[model samples]
Target chain A: MNYIEHTGKYFAMLKQIFRKPQKWIIFKESLFREMEDIGINSIGITAFISFFVGGVVVIQMALNLENPFIPRYLIGYATRMSLVLEFSPTLMSIILAGKVGSYITSSIGTMRVTEQIDALEVMGVNSLNYLVLPKIIASVVFYPLLVTLGIFLGIYGGMVAGVLTDLISMPDYITGLRTDLDPFHFTYSMIKTVVFAFVIATIPAYHGYYVHGGSLEVGRAGTKAVVWTSVVIIVLNYFLTQMLLS
Target chain B: MIEVKNIYKGFNGVEILKDVSAVFENGKTSLIIGQSGSGKTVFLKCLLGLFETEKGIISFDGRNYAELGIKVRRKLREEIGMVFQGSALYDSLTVEQNVMFPIKMFKNSSQKEMLIRVNEVLERVNLEKSNKKYPSELSGGMKKRVAIARAIVMNPKYLFCDEPNSGLDPQTSTLIDNLIHEITVENNITTIINSHDMNSVMEIGDKIILLKDGYKVWDGTKDEVFYTDNEAVTSFVYSSNLFKKVREVYTGNIKL
Candidate 1:
């Protein structure tokens, strides 16, 4: 479909949603499923990625700052800055794009290929409202929660690295982290995560909902949805950071 | 009644439906019979508004389909119940949930009322005890029954079935056809069915429309079909061995 037609259908779906919002029950069910799938199941990967990323950052910082003149406690400040501004949102989005994006694509694409969407249409139900809206709502709502979890794990990983490497004393690490951190930085990271979550959820669900052909086509669509949404997440991350930081 | 007039539809310059038109009456089983690529399915989709016809007007009960607003279209759609070619039951939902879906969507029935309606429809389809089974666990015939039960759960005025017996055994196919016919008569629904099955054609074809290359080549009653001199239809109909045996029996050529 062309962009104009697609956009028109999207707005039509939105309009249909307002007419009968009683279907919010579907959204609630979807949110529950998405939270479990995207958030709870993702904890392991998030923790692993955060741990390794923190370790890598500390190693890189130690190698570069071998000059005895520079205080090693600033490593905590550097770690804090990267975690709050860049790593948390970016890494969380990448994980979500792989996990939640693929899930939405597969679920909706399966529904589409199997004619469940058509069945809904035949029943005087707006398929987009029933299928896509719940997913969009879930992503817009739960993505921030997932991002918060990501940030918490990432920070904890950094703390683990600080203690293991002894780059700074434990007290100095804690003090440096507290002194350099700004609440606004956390807020900015959260805002970015929210936007990324929306993109991850909406793009994949859109691709899946509009998928045609059989299971093979749905599988192809799911792959495409993940790849394209991840690319969009990365590109949007750059632009959002530039704007927000500026 | 549904009127499809001069409908033409094409995909990628390949015509799927070419100047097709037919009238499906209320309280009758109107079967569209043709080969796979002969556009019977496409024509059905056109009637259902699933695919847009490039040049045609489809009117349901004297209202132009294209001119109806979304709300009106939805209201019109509520009058339609479709049994898809594949049954199209939701795998994740139980049979009871699937049957309840339409009622929950379009009606103001309470929980108790909806359950009563679901059970009633399930019983009507002879599936009262199988409400808890998922689509995956049911047989092909059973799934088709569930599809029928779901389709009619809303008490729709128009019912459409696409290839109602495509994958069923002969016995099951006949049963399904009879069930659909009986339901149409009982509910006074204008039922349009797409099928190439000669068995279905002879069984429930109160109004039969034969399509060849997307054109309505023949439209008449079932008895008229057997006697009609349309060479194309005769060749198509008599290609079945069962019809040939019936022809033999009629001609008194059977040897004891």
Candidate 2:
């Protein structure tokens, strides 16, 4: 349909998804399964990407600020600021929008095509609430922890890279990290992470839940879910930064 | 008994079911047979309350379906069990877990009690030793049996099957048909099966409703099916050369 129709349908779906679950025990079990799927399964990729990106950021800063007047400690300070303010929250979520987003879409889409979702509905279960809400809860609850790990590993990687390259000493880098630590920046990063996590979980679910046709359509929905999630995250990143940091 | 009264269903302003009406009785296997695109699925979905009709009434055991509130509708759903055409077993869950799912959702029975019920239904479906196997590990007929076990695990009052014999070999198809018929008789469930399988139609169809191009052209018992001169029914039932011969032999038109 058109953009307005899609927007209306999305809000309508959210309304359905937020209902009280039929059975709390089942909901709890699904929630735990989702947490493992969305959070724990993502550790390796998050760590690998964050660590390498952190090192690359430090190297770029060191090379760009190579001048007699500019302080060497600025390299560490810039790495810390960039990662805490934008990289860990926004960039990490964009990656998850691709990784986790496609997974949710394809899985839910598969269920839709195969009539598993219909079976749930036939069984008097709220299919949307049972399938999507758990993912939303899991991502919102554990994404912050995942992003926190991103921030820590990212900063550590920067420290390691800077010390190994002799571009900046460990003590100077440590001092730069502590130079102007504002608790709110971390809070801002967290707020952004939470928002993006919701987007990552829900957009994909929306795509999957509404998927029609068969396997070919499911694949198309997965692609569309990832693309729309990334787009929404980027747009929301700008707006959130404006609201929270300004 | 499920009473459908002049129900009409449409999608995107295109009429799919055109004022179709029929009564399905309890403890009997009623089959809705139609060609592809004849709206049999829509009719079945309408009966299952998966699709809301634009007009007319469907009452289950004297209670109007459309008039029921959301909570009441859901409560009604707990009494309804559906076996989808694809046998939509949850791929991630093993056969035991899949069969136990509806019970786990709706009943507060103890784990031991639940296992007993699950095993009882599984054994009834002749799937005694296949609890740990996943859907992917099972053959087509086995998967359909698992789906049946899951559908009946809650001891539902109504059981609906959509094309249950679609993709099985003739022996397996007959086996599935007999299993469904036996279950209906044993549980006294108002079983409604949507199928184009003439074999299944002849075997277990206590009542057969024929839909052609969104209309109920003819409906009767298996014996009446042979005697009726309804063009739509004959065209559909005796469509193939093999069925034409079976009809001839059954009617004593020529020596076997």
Candidate 3:
């Protein structure tokens, strides 16, 4: 489909998901299941990557500031900026775009192919609301929490790297985390994750919900959902950064 | 009764249903039957309101679907129970949960009351013991039974089944067919089944509409199927050599 048509349908799907659920109990159950699937399960990977990547960023910073005149604390400062400003939110969200986004797409897409969605419609259930809303709500609630975790872990990772390398003293690393910390950077990160969370939830759902054909198409939808979600996240990240930070 | 008048449906201007009309009488198992690509599934989807027709007015008990407000439409839809080709059970839910799903959605019954009704339906379909098992664990026949149990759990006024016996063995297919017919008669529901399964057609098709490439070529009962000279109907109904020979014997054109 063309961009205009895709955009129109995406908005149409967005509208479909906001209605009151036919069964509040069912919706509540589904929502909790999604939180477990998208959030709780995601904790391990996000934490692991955030820590290791954060340490690697600090090491890279140390290597780059090879000049003897440069202050040791700059490693901590640069790691702080990277962790809070970009790495935690953007990189982790891209990872989620792969992990959570594909799950939403493949599951919904399989339902479409299997006539499970049709069963919902025939029974007067709003398939989109029943299927997509929980994931959207879950991602919205959880992405920020994950991003917060990512931020704390990233800085801690940086601190670990700094102290172990003996390039910066432990006190200096702690001082670096405290020094000139603008609360707005976190505000900026939260806002970006919220937008990307919306992106991650809805875009994959759109791909999956409209998918035609069989199992092959469902797999295709998963790949397409990831690609589109990541693209939207990157693009939205730039805009949110420009609009919020600038 | 469900009446669809001059239904016209198409996808992207290419017609799949061409001004077809039919009545599905209450307390009877009416069927839409045709070869593949003859739009049987599309016709069923149109009847189920899963697909919107470009031109048609389908009514249930004199109430027009198009004219019903959202709340009313939903009310009508809630009265509909569908057995999809794949049975369409939520893989995540156990048999009992699947059966309980619709009653939980439409009624305000307590869990005990709902479980009683769920057990009743599961017992009717002979699936009471499979309550805790998930859809993944059931055989094709068991899954279809579970699908049937789920469909009728709400005691819907209308029931739609798309290819209820498509993948079952002959014995299981007959069992599914008999169960559907029995439920339809017992509940007095306006049941419409879409099938290319000839065994189902011969056994339980109370009213049958034959579609040929989007057009309703014939509408009649199974007995009429034996006598009709309409080549489309005869060719389709007696496509098998055994059935053709039986038809010849019935018409006295061949010796016993």
TM-score of each model, paired residue for residue: 0.93, 0.99, 0.98
Candidates sorted by lDDT, descending order? 2, 3, 1
- Sorted into a CAPRI-style docking class, model 2 comes out as high
Which run of 10 residues does model 3 chain B get worst, by summed lDDT?
B242-251
- Per-model DockQ against the true two-chain complex: 0.61, 0.88, 0.82
Model 1 local distance difference test score:
0.82
Residue-by-residue lDDT tens digits, candidate 3, B57-127? 99999999888897888789989999999999998899999888888878899999999999999999998
Residue B32, model 2, lDDT: 97
**Per-residue C-alpha lDDT of model 2 across residues B1-256, encoded as one tens digit per residue:** 9999998999999999998999999999999999999999999888888899999899999999999999999999999989999999999999999999998998899999999999999999999999999999999999999999999998889999999988899999999999999999999999999999999988999999999899999999998887889999999999999888888787888687
Give candidate 2's whole-model lDDT. 0.94
Cα lDDT of model 1 by residue, B60-175, tens digit: 98999988998898889989999998999988889999999888767777889999999999999899899889999999999999999999988888999999898999999999
How many angstroms is residue A210 displaced in model 3 relative to the true structure, after the best TM-score fit? 0.6
Compose the digit string of candidate 3's lDDT tens values, residues A36-137. 999999999999998998888888888898898987777788888889999989999999999999999999999899988888888888889999999999
Error of 3 at B14 (Å): 1.6
